[model samples]
Target: MEWMSWTVPTAAFFIVIGLILLGMTTWELRSPSVLRKGLLPIATTRGDRLFIGLLGSAYLHLLVIGATDWSIWVASALSLVWLLAVMRWG
Candidate 1:
């Protein structure tokens, strides 16, 4: 279709998301997660933390881009850190 064009970065993004889903599926099948309270206010399972992390990363990227004159690399780095923190202790 005319709207189906895929840039390299866009394709790579989807590929990464697919891989994350696949890995999460495998992990869940191998070892199930238990809901636990972390630094986050609510109890979360692995998937819950993953969702929060991804959402927070998106917000962090937006904030970095909108609030600073920094480069995209800086925003990407901040987003990565936010993702890691959320995954670890969210």
Candidate 2:
């Protein structure tokens, strides 16, 4: 079960982040902030939803890579910034 040492913690971390984002999204939907009220609103267009999903996945994967030290944290940070930029600009 050598993989568990890696997979378990990674899975737990992903779950935690997923939960955090879910709660944040829910809160934003019920009463959106300035940013959420703009792009990522509850009634998002299909393209917006796809963009959000892809960015969200990329963000989470980059976070995992950051945690595992397979790469620099800068990449993950930049990925997060990229997600925000796309959500804002798209």
Candidate 3:
């Protein structure tokens, strides 16, 4: 059987995600989240905000890539900003 090939960037991406999940799990175990309202209409916990941020970032990246002639770097930067904003105030 052939093994899957992994590139450095791809591996790094997964590694970062794993680290975030680990950190979140540890934080949750130490102190559970409480629902709070932010800029988003509904109250959300940390995990909910994280999920929304990640999903929004995906859509932002796709929209930027599909609807514009911007470089991937630009899309990535925009997605990062969106993710941060969502996590902070969504």
Indicate whether candidate 2 or candidate 3 has the larger TM-score.
Answer: 3
State every prediction's TM-score relative to the real structure: 0.90, 0.42, 0.91
Model 3 alpha-carbon miss at residue 55, Å? 0.6
Expressed as tens digits, the lDDT of each residue in 2-85 for candidate 2 is 544558857876896688568667876887554234444465643454457566858776676757765655556666666666
Error of 1 at 8 (Å): 1.4
Q: List the residue pairs that clash in candidate 3.
A: none
Ranking by TM-score: 3, 1, 2
Model 2's lDDT to the true fold? 0.61
How far is each candidate from the true structure, as Cα RMSD in Å? 1.3, 6.9, 1.2
Q: CA lDDT, every prediction?
A: 0.90, 0.61, 0.92
Q: Count of backbone clashes for each model?
A: 0, 0, 0
Model 2 residue 1 CA deviation in Å:
7.2
Cα deviation at 42, candidate 1, in Å, is: 0.5
Candidate 1, 1-90: lDDT as tens digits:
377889998899789979998999899999999999989999999999899998888898999999999998899898889888988888
Decoy 3 TM-score against native:
0.91
The lDDT leader among the candidates is 3
Candidate 1 regions with alpha-carbon error over 4 angstroms = none
Candidate order by lDDT, decreasing, is 3, 1, 2
